[model samples]
Target: MDKCGSAMEFLENKNILITGATGFLAKSIFGGENLEGSTKCQETLFTVKSSKRDDSFGTQLIEKCIILIVKVIGKDLFQVLKKMWGGDFDTLISEKVCLVPGEVSLSEMGLKDSNLVAEMKNQVELIVNLAATTKFDERYDVAVGTNTLGVKHVISFAKQCPNLKLLVHISTGERGGLILETPYKLGESLNDIQGLDIATEQRVAEEKFKQLEESGASKEAITSAMKGLGLERAKMYGWPNVYVFTKAMGEMVINDVKNNLPVIIIRPTIVTRPSTVILLDMLQVTVGYATGKLTCFLAGITAIIDLVPADMVVNTIIMAMVAYELKPSNKTIYHVGSSARNSMRYIDFQRFNYQYFTKKPWINKDGDAVKVEKVTVFNNMTSFQKYMNIRYLVFLKGLEFANKVFCHSFQDKYNDMKKKINFVMRLIQLYRPYLFFNTIFDDTNAERLRMDIQKKDRETETFLLDPKEINWEDYFMNIHFPGLVKYVFK
Candidate 1:
């Protein structure tokens, strides 16, 4: 079949319901530059719930416009508007998209209006469950409620949808170590934990929380315990973090309950923007005058960063959705990542970061250029610790001594500086695993889908899914980094 014909056949007249529509991944899928003005689907329903209690009409309108601009026109355009005139542009996307107030964590997606829920069930053709807590150190109760039991609720809702043809579950490629484009069964022990069933698990988790509360446990103690439980449970299940562990369980639930329904599991690894949260935090620390102009410290960190641009991930998702819809599959798992196709090590990413900052040094409030020096790279933790002692700890001690000897009143300031440095170190320790991650996701299925697209379709379809086509250095330098600086860093 021709590309246009294939796309039309798959997406024409389809009503897609996306959970977590406000999230990074879903926004990329529906509002990516490639899909802009080329969305073949008839209508998209984004499920959302306002955290604000007194949300006014003006607030809603602004929220809607922001969604349209980011998910539709892309952030680059939004950044352009802010940069050009310090003004905003309105969107015409409301005509094609509908925002339905709902919460995925609740039953029936927390939709209070039964009629609206029924209407959605009757008309929705595709259901994409992208709602989940992505924080690695998320609390156990929250993670299980949203990521584990939430999948069950979505599956139940999908089963009720009379017109449902496809149900896509967005999972993490980092769940199983060295992910392969194949079915993975949780270990027997992990399976046993899952066998407790969603309801039972939810009850158990809640009861644990309640028991801790009744025991008069401190909030910090309870939080630490919950976090530890999540980590221990994840380790027992052979997963790395709570985020991936719960996501894996969510997939398991779908696999067990899908029952002949067409389902596609898209596992994407480290789906990042031009600048990731870590990079942003690092920049905030190292680019300031207080950090002694350490621009090259990030470059010294040696690790493999298996990252795929958010745009690339979204393109793959849209194409996969269309391809799977055109040819129904009982269950298909696609690894949409760059590790197996075009991998960029941490060192390379650091080099690009250093190069970018070196060319455009951050100007401090004092109107002085803060330049970065070449950093010392340490491979082992021992060496890193030794370097930290010599570079920062010793310097801090000297400062403390000077304050004590000369300016005794500056003790508070010296203590504050020490705390800030320690906090930064803690942040680095928290992100140590991801900074040094080495897992490679096998994207065989995703690649085959890219190749399967008809030449005619390839020409007409704006969204390209091939990871091999991506140029990492160019994308980071030109597209990603600039967007990050303008939109996020600004």
Candidate 2:
């Protein structure tokens, strides 16, 4: 039997639970949108049978596996599933997929219904925890609640499942230098801070909240203070931002509690969608350049910007899940991206953007092509600040002087331009660490997994997770850029 055959056999009739099904990456998992938002739907269970057989590897896997979505609260996600199944939607919902709504930050994922929770505990063999708050400067309480405590809740729930074979946790790799595929040991800190404890962090957040409440701080003030505290704590512990710090803590939580449970962490770098704010600043920059709003960029032209498509990451996750289940190895980390293999440098990215948009320019509301030019690149903060002052700030100062003398005729334009400048500067400050990052994620384990799969199957295209096969130029000029124009550009 081939590897694909073995995987299919292993997946047949298996019950799988996917948390955070309404998130950006999870939407790709179900191939749909959460039309009515992620919070509106409540606990509801569905027993669905495979709708139809397809040529794609994902659909093929779906045909064999029974997927239980635990966090899908609205019909929008299911509607996409319905569209994929067409007339068979009702039948598939009845026999193929299972829907159970719950929140991961809550204990036992907030599954208040005892009967449903017990049923899930008995039937669920595989669990994938993708629930996360990916903001870099998210409020301390919210970040700890979702990214850190949520992992604890999921692990606790997993411990109750007697038949659980594997728990795959979605993480990320965003630090600079040579990043290796390795598990984060319990209470480990990137800055080597001794005695890092998850419980202590939670206690600190609670105390801070109480302090703010006792002082009668306004909601806005509390929010601002919490955000600031998250950043401060993250920096104190040697992380660049709050998101990665909490995510690291999340891995710690899993290590602390997952005694004998089979767990694997998939740390993909900069997926096409910015789930972890790692690529969010880049995405915003791309949109600005494509629409002719951006004229300057701060980046090291020679630095590599690692990126993997969301579908590719999802494919890797599915394959990793099966590979780990079959082999049951102690190696828990896998970095899935195209940085060390087929790296895309900032220069090439800039060139691709210029080529794509210049040839096919964005049309404005006035029915004219928005001409785009190669943006002036500043490799360092000093140069970028000087350029900003000479180009935008000088104009703003002129506008400010003229506003007072000319009865504030240019007030709206001045304010708008000033706001844009301030926003861009803040973004640069928030993402300065990553802008010139020179990290190369070591993906030896990921490569070995791919090799093992292909060695048995021989036909590798069906499960294309290897990042070395991507042609950066073609992907950017054709697929990625066009998708941005159609979906993201205003």
Candidate 3:
């Protein structure tokens, strides 16, 4: 359309193409059907591996959206979606949403014709790049391939697009592990990254990578090579961790090449679920480790989990796009995270559990209700487990004393109980690293700009980022627990 300032005006008639259309951030924006009066727009999603990856969840999202959209338009939108993607992912999409499917990682996106690329260059008005390898434990080589080189492709494609207006790149809020006690202060980047040309570096790196891979180098060897790349990056840009290191490279790539085209960088922190999305519980490695390890928690455990609900995180991303597009700023960054105002500590979760489940309704087998005169929540988990062992020894001695006196015994019951408690404590310790640590993300910019609503050019309401928005209590009691029982166990 015409040049405009606000996202509403900016997005008017804009054909927006998004990579990582199935990721946490994009999933949040795709929830646009939930928004009241959000007029449908022409959009295409690029998810690299639709069949190979853990995309069952992503497919569900597509299905849900298409269903919702069909209800709204009261007409067939499936054909439109099919033409966009060049396939029938209609079952994978919801309400007749226009969808274009292809892997963002590969050149030409695995499409049959070069014309599709030409078509994308012609029709698409805006692009959102969210595709990347977020796995921190990923082999460094693969991470760089997807996160670094894939980004270069996205940038190159965007540059080729004749109608491109704004290319909004969704990045992680913690681009670097660098933390300042204050929010506004920018710290040293992991790499110097000064005067870096992302596209050129990618071309050179791709040759080197192919050479090494062709020789059949071990994954470990390739990883070492990638780590070496990180050093070169660190020397250039000052960031730590492969994920952030490449993302830092990504940010530079967009900044260096982008001239007049407006770009918005939206970063979100570790995404999880307090309520909405189902958390895994089948594998002993499940969210129910809270309940699973309750006994062990009376013993000391370390390791804190860093997470936020998926919906909240996505909500922020959508808000950032709207706010930044509405914003006059060009090539700006918005850290869309929760550390600034909302801090949910592991200590609080520990205290909440100890106060309820163990005390009043804590019933052992045989329908016998036993109540200790008083129970205090243990802060040091390891010490609590040690204390439990000591108590177990003491109880054995007491049983021996009573077995001789009463003549009949409680030996078998006590041993089984002790064993269970011990197992529970171990489970709690297993969950420690994620539960106790502070990756404490800060998003001062995102919080302010996101969730602002206007009606007739006047401010109507503002949004709040409270974990309390969805009941944390029911999250554990009903949904978290029952969902585990139904979906995971089954």
Candidate 4:
């Protein structure tokens, strides 16, 4: 379908409701022109404002943006925005941005303000659902509540908005091997498991909760049990972990319940933000190695690791939103990742990490340069497990007996070592699917959307959603690694 108007023209006087304002992606959306030194984003905003659309359009953006954030992260949510605008931030917020405290997991999005809800229903033209629990091993009940039921609630809310044009749901591309830009059919799963019902899954989680409660399980025990249950359920249905499984179910909910409302699902893979948490597993491990804590790595060294800049993903979302507004669709899926167009291998990433750290070694608290080494890589799980057994597991087993003879003096040390090992093993299990991932995110639909934007003159040129343009080596060496040190590690 061909959309008629430009993004600027379509967005004119629009009221947008964005859920999960506390999230990194949502914040980036709010930042708009003030992202990651993106002068292009700034230029685009000024260009749009300067355009001769109308008297009001030239003075301010079309969006009267509303955001929903939980109290936990809402305390400092606007600090960055405030920094960007300084004294004028409050005035700008008063005029354009509206902050609402709520939880998407609850019915009506936990939005209790009746008058404000009424206002949103009357004026909201677009809805972007960015609320999600990204923990790979999150509790089953919690994941479903936010990821699955959350979408249902958002849709229910959208149905109330008389002027709603489109709803954009931010999802992840975690399904392995040639992931496509296609909608998930209700009850259909990656592993082809039958009877994969959302209602059944919800029931299962609730029943498990009841069982734990009846057994007088402690809060910590319940949390651990629920986390294991999520992974268990996910693996049973052919997914790797809790986050992706629940998110996939979220998409299913959209397909099942969206009764003719325009919808777009954007699946981004391993999105990296400058000062925010980088979603890639390798980067976390690399951090350990950089600090001289990790000596070996487990991964399919040759496997392709999909990576995309967060700003690029945001740009794609914006383009998709405008496209949907111009040409409404019942459902459309876009895989906004680099795998299909520009792929990076784990081996190359490893080399880059080594090169970067070796050249500029980390300094310890003692003011000495920590030495570096090329970590031994294991291509298979068996080898990795074997290595772990030989290297540390055997010693821990012996330490179990030694603790009894030493008046339990070594008990604390043994416990710490065992706990660290368990944690590492758990992390490895959860991340193995990605570390050895063999997938290509097909972005044909995304490319078409880019082409559509391209045809409408270069005004939309600043939205650089194309992954093929990125130089991976240059980006990691000069941009990603240094940013990690400054913003995250430091």
lDDT per residue (tens digit) for residues 395-462 in model 1: 88988898989957678878898998887676666456676676778887877777776453755344
Model 3 stretches astray by more than 4 angstroms:
1-14, 31-39, 50-101, 106-112, 173-240, 274-306, 351-440, 451-486
Ranking by lDDT: 4, 2, 1, 3
Lowest-lDDT window of 10 residues in candidate 2?
A: 35-44
**Candidate 1 lowest-lDDT run of ten:** 274-283
Worst 10 residues of 4 by lDDT: 42-51
Specify the highest-TM-score model's number: 4
Better of 1 and 3 by lDDT: 1
Write the residue-wise lDDT of candidate 3 on 439-481 in tens digits: 5555544444543433223322333344335555555555554
Q: Write the per-residue lDDT of candidate 2 for residues 17-114, one digit (tens) a residue.
A: 87776566675554422211222122213322222333553453344333344334232435545656678656554564555556677777766558
lDDT of 4 by residue, 1-490 (tens): 2443555555556777877765677766766442323221211110000122233521233321211323222424346665767787655555565655556778887665588678778878888888888999999999999999989998999998888888889998667667878888888878888989899999999999999999999999999999999999999889999899999999899889888888889999887762232322236776788888888888898898888877787888888887776666543898888888889999998899899999988777788887889999999999999999999999998998899888898999999999999999999989988889898888888898899777764667766677888888888887777766664553
User: C-alpha displacement of 392 in model 3, angstroms?
Assistant: 21
User: Per-prediction TM-score, please?
Assistant: 0.81, 0.84, 0.60, 0.87
**Candidates in descending TM-score order:** 4, 2, 1, 3
lDDT value for model 2:
0.74
Off by over 4 Å in 2: 1-4, 32-84, 273-282, 392-421
